[model samples]
Target: MKLALRKIRLVVHLLYGMWVVATRFARVTAQQRLELNRAWSLRFLQLAGMRLVVHNDGARIDEGALVVSNHISWIDIYVINAWRPTRFVSKAEVRKWPVVGWLAEQLGTVFLQREKRSDAKRIMHELSEHLVAGHVICVFPEGTTTDGRELLPFHANLFQAAVSASRPVQPVCIYYEDAHGNQSTAPSYIDEMSLGESLDTLLRGTPLTAHVYVCDALAPGAERRALAADAQVAIEGALDRLRPVGARVRQAAARGQAEQDAEVPHAGDTPAANGPLAQ
Candidate 1:
């Protein structure tokens, strides 16, 4: 009964949120739009019975910063935006989603077609321009959502935008925890799970908490691949700190090996390179 009530509230909130975004977002200043986005994001999280807990180690997210994080679910976007309004680099398919798509467009998301090799350059250029305009651009370098158990290899392509614009890259780590404070799989938007299914799972489950850890920022001018590798290490380290005692020891050993592997380039590896934008 309570789950059903929450679902109904979520639907109503979505309707009202979309209306406000569609109407007032266009006329507002950048700062105003950011505040509106933050407000709606907070409400969205509340409707889903999720609490956002952010841990920043004194690292500031400056304007023209490239904020990169590990992806767990669709709600990851809102969880991050609830704290800091950023221009997200999302897949092109997100632009076709129903009400959510329209809201993302209004929030200034940069949509990219992943199947098209040429599209990367176009999106990179777009991101660079946004950074030049002093906007914080966020990207999920994992390129897809994970189950919140491990970190995926960060793709080096999009990091080039920060290099092109000479913007610092901030690494952020996110985890979903249950009422017991253990890592939760209830919120994982993994294989074959529709957005509706994910919503139902959360709505029926206990309130979940999102942990956002902001790590040190990598200075501009490093090659994109190196930057991506460094950011991955930072995020992996943060996740290690969040793990249970026994798990933390195992994860630390694995992470040390991974860091060493990242330092050794494969024979086919090349320096950061950006192709011309698709015409």
Candidate 2:
């Protein structure tokens, strides 16, 4: 009964968000839009029974920076938004998603068409413009969701936007935990999981706390791949530090799974691996 009530509230809140996007988004200033996004995201997290705990080593770049993070679940987007609102780079198909898609478009999401190789260049150019305009652009370079035990390779293409705009790259690390402080994979949206299935899993779990660690920004170097590599390393180190004893065990198991998966050439591995838009 409690889970059902929470689900109802989430649906109503989602509807409210859609209404706000349809009505007020057109008239709001850029700063107002960011604030609105932040507020809605925080409320979404709260209603989902998740709390955000952010640890910043230093202040985030104010003038505009490319924010990169490991993709764990769709919830990762909101957790980051709850900390500091950022315009995200998502795949083009997300623009066609039901209510959420329309809201994402209105909320300043830049959609990338991943099918055509040329699209990456186009999206990169678009992202560069956003950064030049002093907008914080966040991308999950890992492209797809992971179980928070490890980070997949960071696609270096999008990192070029920051280099082109001469903006810094902010690497963020996120993981979830249950109320008792044990690492939780309850938020991971991996495998062939449906959105409804993922939500149901979360609704049935105990209250969760999302940890967002803001690592130091890397300078806009000459090479995007170099930047992406460095950012991935930074996030991996952060996640390692964030893990508990149980999580380490899970990580070792996950490593074995990764190795086995790598040996098999699956259809899921392709350019599209880096194309998913966030939740």
Write down the TM-score of every candidate.
0.87, 0.86
Estimate, for each residue in 1-279, the C-alpha lDDT of model 1 and write its tens digit.
Answer: 587788888778878888888788778887898898888889989889898888884786759899999999998999998878788999999999988888788778999999999898889899999998899999999989998889999999999999999999999998888887778878778899999898888676658888889998999999999999999999998887776676677767888999989966577766434523323
lDDT digits (tens) for residues 1-279 of candidate 2: 587898889889989999888899789887887798889999999999999988874757766799999888878878988999888988798888777788788788998888889888889899999999998999999988988877899989899899999999999999898888887888889999998889888777659999998999998766988999999999998888788877778878988999988766467655334355323
Tell me each candidate's RMSD, in Å, in order: 11.0, 10.6
- Candidate 1 structure, TM-score to reference: 0.87
Error of 1 at 103 (Å): 0.3
For candidate 2, list the clashing residue pairs, or say none. Answer: none
The residue pairs that clash in candidate 1, if any, are none
lDDT of each: 0.87, 0.86
- Best lDDT goes to which candidate? 1
